[model samples]
Target: MSENLKKDYQLCEEIGRGKFGTVFRCFSLVSGDDFACKSIDKRLLTDSLDRECLEKEAKIMQLVTGNPNIVQIFDVYEDDSYLHLVIELCNSSDLFDRISKRTFSESEATAVMLPLMEAIAHCHILGVAHRDIKPDNVLFNEWNLLKLADFGSADWFLGGKSMSGIFGTPYYVAPEVISGRDYNEKVDVWSSGVILYMMLAGIPPFYGESAGEIFEAVIRGNLRFPTRIFDSVSPAAKDLLRKMLCKDVSKRFSAEQVLSMSNSCLILIVLFKVEN
Candidate 1:
């Protein structure tokens, strides 16, 4: 632990753990404000790529800090052995845990998705792409407001340029990414679409016994809505999914377009008092 970090905050019990490090509940000594300190073990970053990713995560978090749905990073501290990130504390369960607990109504799913897409749009507008956007990275605060966290796989994609990398979770990765093609920020939109599909259908649109199988299914890009599972899902919702999950990058809807369609439905819901 860094001496400066210890002097500035009081680290409490561990709150979460991941492949790279542990997150702890911490309190500021000066203001008594609560925060999460993600302490990354430097020893585990065994290669140059791992070190670059750590730095990029911190930079991207800071770059998108002001968005309402993106988690905030308050401070960064580095010592010889560990790197610490003081981030906004979110006490509620992650989206994955919440989804596993119960089924969601279309309205409920819409509510969750609106803020999430907003966050993605914000990132894209700022020239950043959140390559990894699975449910595990979606957090909630005490008030149940959604927050997009963990930008470990985020990168810049400015001026409509394509980015080349295989960076994303299997279940939600874009088809272009699976094919090893140069992709842009639209990849995040595809991942968000998968999240929406999971929310409504109670499962991912593409699946397999292993990551390789999942990638094959993704690359094949055969999007379907099983009648039994999607019988109750609204047509407008399905239309949005089709646009978002389109394999052809040129045909896929951007984050802003998805938000526009969603907002339009929300307007109709208000006028006609519809459930969808």
Candidate 2:
């Protein structure tokens, strides 16, 4: 977000808050659009590295603003207490919120994925990887496009920290991330794989009694597609899921490859895998 980009919105009620700052609803005077303003406190961000990571996210948002699939960062500003971020206000909540209510069909999966893939595709081309990509981080706009948000953990290949922790949601953790291996863009593929698996299966690929058990299973690369759950799913959809969740990053499907599977690819990515 560019400070030079003028801030023309008046802040409304708070919508979200995190470690760094709070998010509020606002109305944009220039575009006449509703937007969310994220206010980050520079004082709370003590670590220089972490602060730089936030800065990098803002910078990337500048490039991805025009992308249809991405959450648009309308403007950025700083005052005495905090840095204000005016981003596109997604009317709908996150995928997790939806999962808590109704069941979804395969066609619905395609609708959600179209924009998700487009935004992610943009990030990959720019060499930026969203380290955290679970259901909660994925928001929905009025059109039901999955607006990828919460870029707090997002980092580029050349900068940011040595990402070695168990970063993402336990259910979505990729093998490489669990192993503490120096990973790359492929980590996003692994997360998307988990999302796709849940979308089609109504549950994650692996299950355990505890977080330790889940991490152990992930670290071991244990994967199983039960015929009982997937009995109704198409072969092409299953094939696409297999490609996204492939343990080896070298062979996993790219966002483009997964999107190509489209109508047939629709059923397997999100409707079944997520558990509220």
- Which one is best on TM-score? 1
Residues 9-105 of candidate 1 have per-residue lDDT tens digits of: 9999999998889999999999999999999998899978778889888889999999999999999999888999999999999999977877677
Cα-based TM-score, every candidate: 0.96, 0.84
Task: Assess candidate 2 and give its lDDT.
Answer: 0.74
Model 2 deviation from native, Cα RMSD in Å: 4.9
Q: Could you tally the backbone clashes for each prediction?
A: 0, 14
Reference-based TM-score, model 1: 0.96
Candidate 1 residue 255 C-alpha distance from true site, Å: 0.7
Predicted structure 1: lDDT: 0.91
The CA lDDT at 256 in model 1 is 94
Q: Which stretches of model 1 miss by more than 4 angstroms?
A: 268-276
